[model samples]
Target: MKKLLSILTLSLFVFTSCNDVIDIEQPGTLLAENAFKTVEDLQLGVSGIYNRLDNTTQIRFNSVYTDELAIGDDSGGQNVTQYSLFLTPTSGMAATLWNGSYITLNQINKILVAAESIPVATGEQADYNNAIAELKAIRAYIHFMLTTYFTTDYTDDSALGVIALSTIPGLNEDLPRNTNGEVFAMIDADLTAAAAGLSNQSSRTFISRDFITALRARMAAYRGQYTAADGYAATLMANYSIANQTQFFNMWSDTDDTEIIFELERNVGDTYDRQATGGGGWAGSLFAFVNSTASGSPFMEMSRSLYNQLDAVAGDVRLARYIDPSSTISATPTTSTDDYLVTRKYPGHQSQPLMNDIKLFRTAEMLFIRAEAAADANNLGGAATYIKQLRDARFGAAQPLPTYASQQEAFAAILAERRLELAFEGHRWVDIKRLGARANVSIDRDPIDCTVFNACSLSNSDHRFTMPIPLGAIDVDAALVQNPGY
Candidate 1:
């Protein structure tokens, strides 16, 4: 995927021209003739869409709104309001995700339309089909993410999901929210087309059939389709191995790809290589003002609760990989100013500070999904086996197998494992939203970290679990419905 960056200039030109035409001129006429002329142009359009797939917005919101992080010493009142659980239609994360997703979706639609007009020449149909498949895969992923954050109930197909934008709409088109079933049907169709059309790709950074499989696994898990989720996850697990301790340590620095199934590549001089003061940039910049060390101007540190959990796992590689060694350890951290658990999870790569690739799907997550599925099926022993397998890999030895007394206990154990493995990677809030209630868990912040505002715990039943439709979108279309309790 390094070639993705080499063609950035051309992709940008094509993307910008298409966007300008869509905004000002009518649809389906001059833009296709101007922007996309050949198979090469469509491929560049795919690159342009890939450039917009970012996870920083979700990472920032998940960490700040949940118990994964605490305000650092270098904080200048950044994200304090959000950390205190004040979410609304005007929230920055909601607006960023909503607007960014739609903008990229619009790009995908434009490229798909343009691809229809370009006639495939001899031996170029593969490239043409691949480019289209990549766009659909990306489109499916973006729609899935929107539903993940916005849908009121993942288990209820009849529930309202985000508006399903399959094609470019008129300028004044104010589409109503679609049901979860409708949006999911669109996602399935796109993924089916993508999986059939895409060639087998081994690069972890690019979209491939494996990427579709992983997304399907995650989506199925979110929807509580345990059997389907297990099958999808098992297929991926059989193909990709969990990273060993050494590989796991190297993974944070972008030196290892043993477990990564899909990740967005962030190279030097790319669009997200800079300090993302707004929303879409290096993920590490979400926690720190500078880098991932104590010397770096960190504005947020690992939460004491999360740190304690990692520390408790004796000889666990995750503890060493996640916490910076330069952190100042306090015997009793009773206040916000006491202990600082600096995070090293994104310790730069390629001479870039605080910049690393955003990993979307990993084999370790597949293991967790399998564990959850096992627990959901009342297979407590199977759930424990999966947990022990993951723990044994992280610890670099055969550890004692965990035992579960009941299905609830097994689910709780799986949730705990997910927290340790996927910390600071943008899964905490959604994890809590989807599984906390069943496990009898919630966002439990450290008392010291919550001393400022006492916003320590949030139940999964809270309406804030579902993000409100952004105020920017609702401001124009007053008829658009917002999430409950907004």
Candidate 2:
């Protein structure tokens, strides 16, 4: 593990400062020809690729930049600029998102290229094919994230999307951004090829057929294809059961995977053991310097608005699962420092503080997707039923089913439910960006939380909703067009 981390750390430094949009420099230890000589070698290479995948950047950007979190007492100007609605082409988060994703994509492309030349033995063919399928699945997922964050409009096919890199680019090749239509076409092709080669697997830590389904479900929902999203989500809902209160609590402790569909496993002394500023870090470290506690130097706390919403629920287990037990919740949090509201969502696992697995997909998200689809189709009652079904599991008892009079009301209810359910899992920002205008809502930080910077709200239609193309990439290639209003 130490040796692999050393190689990856060095490789990441090279990848981050490359002149090309997607550069490939071989790691010092493993050359492509010698890396994939056998099925075992291919499997090892895939594991290394998986190490490059982390959502800490998205989680941090979503929480601190949105209404999910507020500046904590321990803050020393960390993310203060972003929390103040200050984003630019040179913003650290933008550059991190662009460079980190392309790095992972390049790694996958490199492995795929090397695997093409491998000699498959009769008995090893299945393993070889499965390895390749997993690579394709991860590639498609990275591209999906890139498109979701970088593209200005998900509904417009002609809108600018990120560069689609299926193969490693030459050192001097400067790639231009592709259209949303082109990127989605590439994603669909990769997913289709992945689905054909993958087989059933029981592990939630690795890519399975269900992972592909979950990705399709999310992509469809983002693209506003309600029918397709509904079908994909329903298949997964039937396969995986939602977690009850006890199961949900255990899930945060890494004691259960009852509701999780896929997560990136983080182990002690692995590639992501330490603090990483942008992409690779413990998800908990994004909020706190040491751990998820008041004394642990938590630089960010759960927003009072979000906490109040959870507290309003009579018996919802998410409130306990999200906030630390040791926190001091003030009756009236008139200021950010009045209440600790320490976040305990990633309390840590395997006796490592703040190092839990990065959960990418869960059955709960699928339920939300179904609810959104129902609302979009004007099946208000059906949408309410799905939301109530989830609430019943969380409260560990039957709850009153909600009612919506209009389609916008149904959408508003669905988005509200999603905000609470998917709180710290990196969905809040994108949720509002895509569904906010439809639901007639946007970022509304509590008066108390935003008093420090006076950045209490952002309109749904604001151009800042779409992240700007990072200046680092643009500086490298002048021809690459930037997102509008950046």
Candidate 3:
């Protein structure tokens, strides 16, 4: 039997009193004071943090709100439209992302700070530190992601920043956001410490040295630190071989694989019961696919440009894995729509549904990073070799390696390939941000405003790129500044 990864659940303690009218207070339990005292306590705290992973699957109501997938066309509820607005960012999705990410950050910070204070009497000291390192790594990971969504560019290291919470919860203070440079410095420090503490461990399914290195390379590439990025990415690619086309899809089910550096696991008893169950609550419906409930509103559809780009490539196995035609559509405006293709990549069903794990870092991504870095460093031949490895895997035994006339062409091809291969995996927006090419594509608006989709032009100057700090958060601390334009 496969071991089920534990998900954390906690009880909230509240106090209420009746005054002249009535005053009620619901004070949240602190992980520092209440949890993380022993191995079991620490385990539960860690589980709580990892439970967020469920949000990435189709089972949770909030799963696909990010760039991963659009609200299916059939959804009419306010939540669906509110989520759709997030894709373009004129609506409140930006605030939600900012708030939700910070919430996770808070949990990580508490875990790290608390874990450090607990004295280890046995060999558990090392285990405690390892757990601390894991939490810290998760903190850095969340920050890296938050910065990508909230800031304009990784190169702008000097901008005024949001608070970098490294300690446990206390009195709210007005801490200035660190510069992008400062933020990356913190991320690197956390990851380096995590790597050192986590080394010599044999758990391949959890976050490991390779995972940290891959993320470091990803951050380096985003910062245009080409040589460092290439070096780290090269180490990863050379050690862990790329997954074959079939293995690429199959590895999602296996959980333990050379390709996945870290992932989130789901099972029967632990399964999300939203859409997977017949219930109509948040977890009850599959938002990525079109259904009778969604009407004609496909929340997210592939852009014509992306669709054509994939169609232009022959014998690419990835296109099939990433997209599937909707056989259930009917003919009226309500149905019979061929445009309603569903993403099968994240299908998590009861038996064989979406048991496929959520990939954190994989060997193929590292190879692409190395290719881009090598190209930027003017090592065209080296860049070409790496690019061919990835392309050939997708094209298989029949197709010949593509030829590029110039370094720029090879670079562009590599990027395009990343976009196609990594779509809906929470990567496209970051890639566009790092490249400073926000102006290149038009934004797709909600389906109700069909004209908005045609007219939504995006530019680097658009304020939408930087999300507004959450209203609730701002209300809590007057000193906390909102992102400019939000």
Candidate 4:
């Protein structure tokens, strides 16, 4: 997935030529059927799948749609209303999640098809199998993302989840929604197979057994499968240690590659058809105010509550690494009556100096997942121990360990820590959805943020918790149904 250093041109060409199974543009040079003829070709197809993920843009929106972001002064209201908790069925936001995810899934499916049929030499068998396992894991991941955003309730098996497409779509076929249970089962199976088959113990840029386990942990935690999540998360966390303060900042700077389980690598050579919203040179326009050609930046800012928490503990390393230290924001808009603090998370690369690598999974997330599951299982003290390791790294040894006195207290502390640690990385909404549902919690945004956007609070039972499928998807797929209260 090294867009700059590897066969990124081939990856991009494959992506554009085969984005949608139904509406694919004919490749002037290469054909989809012919694209994955050899094992090497199928491997390139996997890289192309990464290109689609790079441009999904869902991660940026995930922060915006929840309490993680505030409107910037230099903003358009393109998705501001959705962030205000007034979701629209026909909104472009819904389409972004739906369309972007499916397109990625379809690209993965193409790889799967090619991998299965491609003839391999005897020496390439193991490598080929591992590649196929990686594809399955990626396919599982895309489906998990869809169900997380589209399905109403994670625990409701009967709830309508996304279509479970295992093969390339035919023009005449119309797939129906599967139950949440069904979709999750597929994800679990894929990861299980992937973990058993994948042998790549190194390379954070590619899918490995660690990614499958980490994803399983997230999946289990979201679905309230505490025992299962705790087991999977424990295995991974035991293997990967959290980055220390110095190492942590370096990781964000793209200078160090410790603790990152899987990340999208965007080095200086990533100029051809780069997938971020910011277009080519930059990581996505997610954090830029006026960097190069991208414009999405200066549009969103860090939530005030998040800034306060990060700034609460003196000399916290996360403060500078996560937030723009210069405090440079183009505007902070009328409703959001605070200075715009851009996320320094995507500050920029060294050579390009404006783009940031899109980190997908990190070791710290595994620890948090383990802690969350332990708490869910009523092992509060165990949970505290698990969370404190990361907390100590962030807050330094001087800070006292806050006792997880009661289940509520443990829940509150753990979730609060998650909010801070995972800020702008896009875990805010799903964390609230599943955890809020479990605790019957409601979000009360800081009044300064709430009063401006008119979305100060979102209850556990709010219908906005579940989003509608994209209107465009429904228009074509007769078998698909909209989520309730959409």
TM-score of 2: 0.93
TM-scores, all models, native as reference = 0.94, 0.93, 0.78, 0.86
lDDT for each residue of candidate 2 in 206-266, tens digit (9 for 90 to 100): 8898999999999999999989999999999888999999999999899999989999998
Tens-place lDDT digits, model 3, residues 113-215: 6666666777676666677777778888888876766666676788755567675334434445677888888888899889877743434456677778878
Clashes of 4: 4
Could you tell me which 10 consecutive residues in candidate 3 have the lowest summed lDDT?
A: 1-10
Which ten-residue region of model 2 has the weakest summed lDDT? 13-22
Candidate 2: residue 277 lDDT (0-100): 71
Q: Which of 2 and 3 is the better model by TM-score?
A: 2
Task: State, as a TM-score between 0 and 1, how close model 1 is to the true structure.
Answer: 0.94
For model 2, name the residue pairs that clash. Answer: none
Please give the RMSD to the true structure for each candidate, in Å.
4.8, 4.8, 7.9, 5.7
Better of 1 and 3 by TM-score: 1
Which ranking of candidates, highest TM-score first? 1, 2, 4, 3
Give the top-scoring candidate (TM-score): 1
- For residues 1-486, could you state the per-residue lDDT of candidate 1 as single tens digits? 112222321232444323333233444444545677788877877777777788988888888899999989889999899999999999888888887787777767867887889989999998998899999999999999999999999889999999888976665556778899999999999999998888766559888999999999999999999899999999999989998899999999999999999999988878887887775777888888778888898899999998888888589999999888899878777787888789888888989888999999999999999999999999898999999898889999998989999887888888888989999898999998899888988899999888788799999899999999998888766446899999
lDDT of 3: 0.57
Number of clashing residue pairs in every model? 0, 0, 25, 4
Model 1, runs deviating above 4 Å: 1-30
**Candidate 1: residue 90 Cα off by (Å):** 0.9
